[model samples]
Target: MSIKALITHIQELVSAQSGLAGLNLGLVNYGVPTKLPAIYIDGLTFLDDKLNSHTFNLCYVTTDLSIEQLDYAKLILAALQGSPCVQAQQLLPRPEPENKRNRWIIPCVFFPRALKA
Candidate 1:
């Protein structure tokens, strides 16, 4: 599947959760929301794996609540890790300088190669 499909899936999941119902996941170029608990795809790239597929990382930006952010990250991880096309992932505590937006990164590699058409 494509990166947009994965992002759409995560967006759906985040929307379903009442606690995270308003979270928005978008490409990094999309205007950042003036809200908390948002996610953005950092970028996409081809992977060097045997599958020769694609890899990307999603940045989960939230408020400074460590526990709440952890919960949100866990929810995101669970949603992403459950995808069959997702081969692997590593979620790390990623901090940033923009408005104290606590961040977590979920770097993922997926199959169904993104070779040149």
Candidate 2:
């Protein structure tokens, strides 16, 4: 399946599992209204697994309330990783800007992989 299709499926799965209605899981933040207690998942990428030729990298950004909520989000991400659609999963920290000092910035991507051709 294509990476776009895979991402859509992952978003659907997450929404269904988290009981979130009308969640928009797109690459760009287009002012989607999210209810509190909802988790935001983004920055999904697929890359070559450098250590293993047979596998690929599935990286994404997960942001939520607290550490516990982040853990839950990770669990949800882990479940998605187990699917055949994904080769492997890696949890990457979203990079913070050097100047702007907002410690509570929602997770985002610094370096993202290009879509496979």
Candidate 3:
């Protein structure tokens, strides 16, 4: 899938979420957001020369400091974390923000798809 398609897929995945259904989600140019619980797909990239692979980050922003956000973050992680298709990294809390912040970021990789050589 293309990058745009990947973004759309991510959006769709989150959009279908029952809890996060109406949350503010979109791409980011790296700026201060004006909303809470802002989930953004950013840092466009692919992990392979074939350009069939994709990797990006999800930043979950909210003032609600707790593990509750993890429920939302795992939605993406679980789907891609399966087997052979995609690889998902751990969703960790930001190092700063007093070790208890409002944002958690997960770096996920849609590993390179094997194509006939």
Candidate 4:
């Protein structure tokens, strides 16, 4: 799906809230390879009332997949890199699984354009 569509969907899933929080959801038939079966996301960062800095805490969720872990990671990283608003992107430590399954969580932060000095 297009980035615009994805963003819209995310906004809907998370709903309108006042605070810093993340939202995690799945992405199916995303036109990507099998390695990347799900799309984990955190809450979106937006300018707060103060207009001094962005407000929103990071959140994450995982989805089941039928592909190599490394490949999935690569796809997510690539997608984030392509985005214009994302910055200081990085992956967090892998979480331990309760059962035998393949999962990956890609964490990233979005920083809006700063005012010109």
Q: Which model scores highest in lDDT?
A: 1
Give candidate 4's error at residue 18 in angstroms: 36
User: How are the candidates ranked when ordered by TM-score, highest leading?
Assistant: 1, 3, 4, 2
* Candidate 4, number of clashes: 5
Q: What TM-score against the true fold does each predicted structure earn? A: 0.66, 0.39, 0.61, 0.43
- Per-residue C-alpha lDDT of model 1 across residues 1-117, encoded as one tens digit per residue: 555666655566556666555445443322355566567766677655555677777778877755666877877777767665664466798777565668888887766543222
Error of 4 at 23 (Å): 21
For candidate 2, lDDT tens digit of each residue in 34-95?
43333333444334345222222233233332354345446555555544444334454443
Candidate 3 off by > 4 Å:
22-34, 79-86, 95-101, 111-117
lDDT for model 3 comes to 0.58
By summed lDDT, the worst window of 10 consecutive residues in model 4 runs over 16-25
TM-score of decoy 1? 0.66
Q: In model 2, state the lDDT of residue 97.
A: 42
For TM-score, the strongest prediction is: 1
- Candidates 1 and 2, the one with greater TM-score: 1
Candidate 1 yields a Cα-based lDDT of 0.64
Better candidate by lDDT, 1 or 4: 1
lDDT of each: 0.64, 0.38, 0.58, 0.40
Against the true structure, candidate 4 reaches a TM-score of 0.43
Scored by lDDT, model 2 comes in at: 0.38
